[model samples]
Every structure is written in structure tokens, then in C-alpha cells.
Target: MGTEHRTDEHRTDEHRPDVDRALKADCASCFGLCCVALPFAASADFAINKDAGKPCRNLRTDFRCGIHTGLRDSGFPGCTVYDCFGAGQHVSQTTFGGTDWRRAPDTAQQMFAVFPVVRQLHELLWYLTEALKLRPARSLHSEVRGLLERTERLTGLAPDELEKLDVAAHRRDVNALLLRTSELVRAEARRGGKDRRNRRGADLIGARLRGADLRGADLRGAYLIAADLGGADLRLADLIGADLRDTNLSGADLTGCIFLTQPQLNAAKGDSATRLPPELIRPAHWS
Candidate 1:
């Protein structure tokens, strides 16, 4: 994938689309591939050790987690974040025609292999769908849309094709769109030329603060959990001890956020979409 690109142009005010088009649990359209196809060690994030291709002991015969309603309480928080990006449903219904992994035991391994591939394609879809909503990236929306369509089509390919999926190339294409998105959002971050600060314990939850300038601010001990910080500017801000649990930092600029250590974030929560600086491990709690 390509590296970062900087540009000057404000387009954050354009009407972005709602991203809920992506799939959720819709068990009727999926085979619970994630629970069986992925491996997890016995840890705080999972209740038991399960190897790749092995279904969790708690997985019901009907393809639902036996502990679905209590995954967090049962030490399987990671299961809560295992979104298939609609690929699980696509594979279960469209590509494989609603085949059950159990009934067709012969295709089990193939299904396992294709699950991750479809997942990558679907994750890219999430990003492209999000990029399309960026008004600032309007100049590149056509290209972004093209990539989204192509990536979406790949998710419906045969198991053989999906097994050989070129996810890296698709990621490169999505990164191109994101570069444009960053340029558009970052331009808005430089507005007003007035550095703003928020005090501790401020109620910033669920605030639509995309692309806002927040450099050099004191957000220490702030209650910013679950805040919509996508595309927000956090260059050189003091994030020490800040409560970032569930804060959406996707595509947001944090090139030089001060005191933003990995442990602090590991103590919080985030997803695969979050773009953290190097040397940071994804917070284990995010799952």
C-alpha cells in the first residue's frame, strides 16, 4: 500500500452516507464461520482454546454462539467484534447457496479458507463505503466507487478464486481512496487557527466531531468513550490517561499526538479500522 499524502482542501461538510448498509448478525444468512474458522487461545478474550477450523465448544448446532448474549461476561469479547463485513452471509447464501458447514462436511476446509478472504474484501468495502460519504474526497469519489464495486464483486467469487484472493492489491486501492479522504479531512483541521482545549470529564460521548481541530488540548481523564472521532485532528494533543474506550479514530490524523502511548490505548478499545501510530498493539479489549 502507498504511504500518506497531504493536501489542502476542506470538504467535510458534504453529506456523508450512513454506513449501516453493511451486514450485522443476520444468522439466517450466515453459517457462523467466524466462530469455527478462526482460532483463539484460552484468554481474557475467549473462554476456551479452539484451533483454526475447529468450532467452539459453545457453538450451538444451529450456528449461534451458545454464550452469544453473554460473550463479554464469558471472556469472549473478541467474538463481539468479529464482523464478517457481510461476507459470511454472502458466502453462506450467495456463493455457496445457503450450504451449512456441518451438512456439507466435505467443503468445510474450503469454507474456512474463504471466510478470511471474504472478510478482507468486506472490510475494504466498509472503508470504501465510508470514503464515499466524504464530501472532501468528491474529486476522487468516482475512483473510490470503482474500487468498492470491484472489491464487492470479489467477495462473491468461487471458493478457489477466493482462496487465491489478492487482498493486498485491494488494500492498496483502498489506501489510495483513504489518502484523498485524509487530505480532505485534514484541511478542515487547520481551520480557525485557534487551538481548542477540553477539560477533564467532559461529556463528549457520541459527538459528531469529524475533522475538528483539537491539537494541544488537555483531554486527560476525559469521558470521550464512544465519541465519533472519525477524521478528527489530534496532532500533538495530550491524550495521557484519556478514556478512549470505543472512541472511533478511523482515518483521523494522529501523527504527533502527545503522550499517546500504546499501553494507554491497550487499556481502551478500538477496532481494525482504527489507524494508530506504529509501536501500538491493537487494544485487546476492543474485541
Candidate 2:
């Protein structure tokens, strides 16, 4: 999916030296599960309408995207921003013993059903991994570790078990832990600051926040679509689930920002001057 071309440097978080390499997408080792299992609508992001369990029109016989090098130019920009969090490879290899859907038609439906479930679990793994790295959240580290291990075990469940998993409930439990971790980290970050406003779930769509002092701001789940956040100081801000599509991040400092994923950056507008977290790579389309 989105992380197909990521290099070793981009796949890791240096803060967590023992970060799981399998948490990053390895498209070469995958069965192109994202291309076949997920549905997409015709919009600014995708060029055609696709249904779940149907392979994308551009998917090749060998389970690779035909327009891999020119997906954006070919009007499949949506594919470029999709991160399966390494679920594709895990399902293709571990879940199915490296048997692709094409070879074992009988398993195709179950494979597709299990992919999304495992994907959600992997996303939780990513966040929990980062949570353990936050020094300010040290007191909660043991709890985070326990959940991380539990989530990892969930990903390894049989396809049948994975299909029947109550992923939403599991996500709720994990999110509660992450929320506590964010509070601890942000409190440490804003210890001496007065701008401790809690903007959790705020609707800031297209708002002009240029050069704003958002350091340590609680922006969890904020709708920032097309917002002009250029030159803002977002250090240590909690950005989990924030809609960043076309949001201008030019020259903004996002160093140490909590829960910011690569797909979020890929969907936004940024530039050379934007200070990103060490684990994330700058999108190529940024000016």
C-alpha cells in the first residue's frame, strides 16, 4: 500500500531502537491485499469506483500495481496515501502461509475479511510502540507494554478468529491507554506554558492557523482539512486522527508531535522548512 517504497531509514522510529520492522508495509512480500480487498469510490483521490473483494483495475496478475511508478499521475492518488500498517504482508505470509488468493481461490474471501481486522490491530501496535517511547509517559509504560503485547498476539490469530474479532472494542481499550499517555506527555510539554487549551475533536476545517502557537495543544481528532497551519509551532501536539488533507504545514515545527502517521503527512501540504518528527519522511510532492 502507501509504504511500498519506503526505505529502511523511513520504516523505523529511532527513538524505539527495537521497533518492529514488520509493522511497516513490505509490499514485495505481500499479496497486494490492499489492491484486491479494499473498495474505493471515484473522487479526487481515485479515478474509478471499486468494490470490496474486487481487485483494482490496475492490479497485475503477479499481485502488483501496474502503475506503481505513476499512481498519482494516473489518478490513483488515494492508493498512495493508504497505509495498511504492514497488514498486507502479515496476512499474505503468516495468516495464509504465503498462499495468494489467486492460487487458492477457496481462501480468497476469508483472506479479504481478515485483512482489515489485522490492519486495525497493526495500527494500534504502531501507536502503542510510540507511546512507550514518550519519556513523560514513563509511569504508564508498563500498561502500554502489556497492551502492545496483547495486540501483537491478536494479529497472529487464525483467519476465522480474526474475522470474528471485536476490533472496535479492542480499539476502544487501546485508545483509552493512548489518551492517558497523551495527557502525561502533553502536560510535561506544557509545564511552563499558558496555552494549554484542550482542542480535542475541534472543528478547525480550513481555519487560518498560520504561525499559531500550538505547542503542546491537545488537537486529537481535529478536522483540519485545507487549514493553513504554515509556520505554526506544533511541538508535542497530540495529532492522532487529525484530518490533514491539503492542510498547509509549510515551515511548521512538528518535532515530537504525538501519534502523527506517515499517511497524514502524505495527505497534507508541507515543504522543506517543515520540521517533521524523526520517524516520518517528508512527502515527495511537498514543495
Candidate 3:
């Protein structure tokens, strides 16, 4: 993956303080390594267009994006929606000691490799911490605490150690604990006993489902790309790993859809062609 290093200036300045503070606390010291490490397509999502390893044209000497203010208007709307959940800075400054891939090209690759590993750990931390906050998930508290400690330790690994880390094994262990936590929480949430279609891997591409009742539906790994799901009721829906590419969700209610992240959402397509919830943003890919 070829990506150009960018400064923090490309990121949204008007971030929600609660989120910004948490993300910053976890990752403010590092530079924008992900932008330079990951590869992106020349879709509407990016402005000037770049290769995977190439630094963005707007990147400045200090590693900030020159077009930060105009990122949306300039055609890089996708960048506006991306949040590493605090992975970049943590790896750049803390794990790598404020060093950069430029000064040490070899280390840049290592930094890039360590980021996703840490981000996944952090994402789990976010969920586990949230689970602990729920009264019903109390039974899983001890397990969650243990997972947090392990996850935290992984996040703090040095670049060399992090690059050599076995992230998959850790994820497997974390998944087991998360599964137990999920079951506990799901059992507590009251739901209507409706005989809904449990379509775990249905191919519903481009199918019209406007204003459809889909409460408590199981759509795991389903290919629903380019399907019209406007005004669809998706309360308590399980959408894990579902291929939602080009799915139209205009006026769709996803208030309780679990495990949906900005990256997943961005990878899927939506537009003025669709009306997303206020909380979500329009990815450049959709344009």
C-alpha cells in the first residue's frame, strides 16, 4: 500500500470534543501515518487523487494537509469521515517515539503494519469499556477488565515489537470474551417476537426494500450491495460483515444496528441518491 504522509490539519477541526479528547488522548503525539501507509482508489472520495504509497499532494512539510479546510469541497470527503479510533498518533509518537517513516523508511512500513493491529485492539477496548458501563453486562466485567489490560499492553508495544506481534491470536482471544459479553447484553434487551426472515447470506443486491419492516433481522455476511433500503426498519439488526456496497439507505432507520463502523460504512456506497442518518457522512466513493 502506497500512501502519502499527511499532517493532522487534514482532519476535521470541529470534531466532537468527547470523541476528539478520547481519540487524541490515545493518539495525538504521532504523525498522520495511515494516510501515507494505506492505499485508496481514485474515486470521488479523494480530491487530488493518489497512489497507495504516495503522499497526498496537499501534504505539507510538517505532514499536515494543505487542503484541510477544503477537503469536502475539494473532493476528499472520505477523509473527513475517517477516524482511526486513535491508532495513527499512538503508533507514530508513543510506539515509535515521534519518529517518522521519512527519516526511517523501513520503520514507516513497520509503523503502517502496526497501526491496524493496534486499532482493532483499541476498537475492542471501546466496546468492552462500553459494555462495562451497562448494568446488565456486569457479569462479564471481570472478563472485560482482563481483556482491557491485554489490549492496552498491545497498544503500547514498540514499533519493532508491534510489527512482529501476533495480532490474530489476540483477536481470537478477544472475540471469545466479546461473544460472551454480547450474549449477556442481547439477552437483556427486550424485543418483539416476530417471525422475521433470518437471511444470513442472502444475495439481495439492488432489491427494493423501501419502508420494509426488518426489525431483529439477521443479515450476517449478506450481499445487499446497491439494494434500495430506504425507510427500512432495522432496529436490533445483526449486520456483521455484511456486504453493503452501494446500498441505498435513504431515510432508513438504523438506530440499533450493531458493529457498524465508519470504515465499513464508507466502503459501502450512498449519496444524494440516498438520505443517511444525521450521524453518518457521505463517503467520496458514492459520488
TM-scores for all candidates? 0.65, 0.94, 0.72
Backbone clashes in each candidate structure, one number apiece? 1, 0, 13
For candidate 1, the C-alpha RMSD (Å) to the true structure equals 11.0
lDDT of 3 at 35: 69
Instruction: Give residue 86's lDDT in candidate 2 (0 to 100).
Output: 91
**Candidate 1: stretches off by over 4 Å:** 1-22, 193-287
Q: Candidate 3 lDDT, tens digit per residue, 1-287?
A: 00112232112222224433444323235566656766777777775556656677777767777887888688887776566777777777777888888888877666777877777776766655544544445767777777877777778877678777888898778767755654544443334565767677899988898888876576767889888887788755556657776677656666555445556676565545443323345565564
What is the Cα-based TM-score of model 3? 0.72
Candidate 3 weakest ten by summed lDDT: 1-10
Candidate 2 C-alpha lDDT tens digits along 72-161 = 999988888899989999999999999999999999999999999999999999999998778778788889889998998999899999
Q: Over the full model, what C-alpha lDDT does candidate 2 score relative to the true structure?
A: 0.88
Candidate number of the best TM-score? 2
User: How well does model 1 score by local distance difference test?
Assistant: 0.66
For all candidates in order, the CA lDDT equals 0.66, 0.88, 0.64
Candidates, ranked, lDDT: 2, 1, 3
Q: Model 1: which ten-residue window has the lowest total lDDT?
A: 1-10
Model 1 clash pairs? 77-287
Q: Each model's RMSD to truth, in Å?
A: 11.0, 4.2, 8.5
